[model samples]
Target: MSGPTGILLLDKPQGPTSHDLVGRTRRTLATRKVGHAGTLDPMATGLMILGVGSSTRLLTYLVGLDKEYTATIRLGQSTTTDDAEGEVVTEHDASGVTDAAIAAEVATLTGEIAQVPSTFSAIKVDGRRAYDRARAGEVVELKPRTVTVSAFEVIASRSSGTLLDLDVRVAVSSGTYVRALARDLGAALGVAGHLTALRRTRIGPFDISDAADPEGDLATALIPPAEIAGGLFPTATMDAEAALALAQGKRIPVAVTDAPTVAAIGPDGRLIGLISVRDGVSRVLTNFPNSEEPA
Candidate 1:
């Protein structure tokens, strides 16, 4: 059987890594053309957008969207990776941390602020992943980056002797780290902190509520690229002659104002491709002709 073409929203479970999901999906679909938009840590579980066949081209657009997550922050210990998976570096009594204090610290973290990602992160340092260096027992110093935390609200809190756990929901920009927020919140309260759990609720327009299991036939869950293209950018419907010309990689005289990408629709109402208007001509960014021919 041929490979499935389009996007699949996998409701990723904890334990297995994001790459594991891609490999399994590739085998299940019987195709090698598989890629995921945004990488989730092994401990995280929620919506993961996977692209099958030609839909892999859309991953770039999906990766930069804002994300939402629900997380548990343990406010009594500091971990090497700023999460439960890492070794505890420091332990302290956090029973004194109050709800008012947590809210104040969370407010400081909201909006745009400089955030230093955990050493056990995918960031490249000296041509190597920071996590690799840290894992090898090497000192890793990473610079802080400005990230936007549009929403950071604590839903609940529980105290058990010297330990305190806070449940929070956060909406942040593409590169913002929820683990880092946990770390920072704890630091501000003078009680070391780390993330206990994390579940991504949404990534831009894709939500965990609409996700399917990876163990199932992912081909059946495929969402055509045309279905998503209309939501991402402006659409330009063209005639048969124009669509054919674009399919052949020819530029046509069309005006797409103030938009970097335009969804080109064929006369048959199917997506022709993604295009950019330059010098009064529409140039193809990604082509999707009416034929089901494989690339």
Candidate 2:
């Protein structure tokens, strides 16, 4: 039998990079086909979706899911990296800032807005990562991007001498940056703030509650790809013949609803593949068994 193949929801611990987790999982599972859904900074700890074996093909759909995070923004200082990982660029006394003012400013950033990502970010600038150029002391000018910040609100606040820290929860679209939100919030408040802490609590329907410990045995902890796929999209159960046909890369014409993608399940109870409707024809977007079957 082949090794377990599916998605692994890992509650990634701080300190280890996301790639580090992928490497560990590859070693533990003894497969080099592991891939992660989204990138999480080393300082962030939370749920991460890992695709194993044929399930790696499903990551493109998962990457664009809305995300949730709990973060702390220190309102007295700004950093080069927009987070605690970088050198402090400036400092100011935020003790005079009022709670009412903070709330008003956060409200300004709550809706759809254009935001420039941090220079210390993964976004590419002329084919080079913005972070790499920034770290090399080269100027990196990133254009503003339209991102939806559905919610950006202060949960709590604390003051320590000249500095103020606000505990916040944010719900944002796929490409939104919480660090940039902190930076912009501070800029709006005239106190120059930066992210002091960040933790991802959820990504789409998956939460930390669904994740396995980072140090646990990943192979044994795998969630069947079929199960994960079923939760992500509308499911279409096919009979043995139709399933086999789909698995063999045949387009099985079927009635379509409004779902952009459908999970096609085989009679054997495994995911045959994913399909989409184009011009009223149900076409295979991906064929799972083709990747799973021995080469």
Candidate 3:
């Protein structure tokens, strides 16, 4: 509860669960109030947004941001988990799967579409994780949900024997699973398919290129609350009295339009909270304690 409060853009290495990085961040920063906006599988590596201290309140806003990933989809073999980490469940000769046909199918997968998440995913069923039930040998049935795939472009292709591997870059909305895309792509092309590699490149305004390795200096890597909020939402500068009124849970008069939420900055240029405007009146949606003060 008492430490540097801000966001930490971490480049998570493969083989560690997202939770593992969170734990490591806690140890490095010496704070237990760390939380992440999204998660990646142990076999995946990518940018992970971590909120430290009071910045944990910001995670809720960051979770729904669109994400981008670069991955390899291996055609000719399907796996139980829809990724290379799972056992092979089916195999096919993908050599006959033409590039034009793959491109056509990829086009169909773009835009808004209904998709079923992989059974070995983190989705919860009956208060238990779907993956847990799947590993226990129980059938896990997940419903299809609408998810937008803004872009699904094949960067390169490699063929070996009867297998074809496609390197792809995908931009998708939050909650869209890349593994499922690979699985569905293969199924649509009449061949078995699964993700062989995945690395998230971007999430909203945050990019992997700006992310820091968790093993390095985490304290210095903390991004202040004001900077984090400014990057995500339009900002409204408030005077001392207005900042106090909003902090006291009272509505303040501020003109905001177009955006559903705006970051409220206090007279000192520190983020005070988030506010939403309705008919020119701003109401507090979230309030942050003055980061300069002790917890």
Q: Would you estimate the TM-scores of all the predictions?
A: 0.95, 0.96, 0.96
The TM-score of predicted model 3 comes to 0.96
How many pairs of residues in model 2 come into backbone collision?
Answer: 0
Estimate the overall C-alpha local distance difference test score of candidate 1.
0.89
- What's the residue-level lDDT of 210 in candidate 1? 88
- Model 1, span 1-295: residue lDDT tens: 4456788899999999999999998888878989999899999999999888877888888999999999999999999999999999999999988888888999999999999998899999989999999999999998999999999999999999899999999999999989999999999999989999999999998889989998886767888787788888888889989999999999898855746799888877777899998766888899864654232
Estimate candidate 3's alpha-carbon lDDT, on a 0 to 1 scale: 0.93
lDDT of 2 at 88: 96
User: What is candidate 2's local distance difference test score?
Assistant: 0.88
Best by lDDT: 3
Order of the predicted models by TM-score, top scorer first: 3, 2, 1
Tell me which of candidates 1 and 3 scores higher on lDDT.
3
Candidates 1 and 2 compared: the better one by TM-score is: 2
State the lDDT of candidate 2 residue by residue for 1-295, as single tens digits: 5655788899988889999999998888888989998988999888899998888888988999999999999999999999999999899999999999999999999999999999999999889999999999999999999999998879999999989999999999999999999999999999899998888989999998889987786767888778889999988888888888887878766665735799988776788889986655578889886336321
Off by over 4 Å in 3: 291-295
Q: What is the lDDT of residue 192 in candidate 2?
A: 98
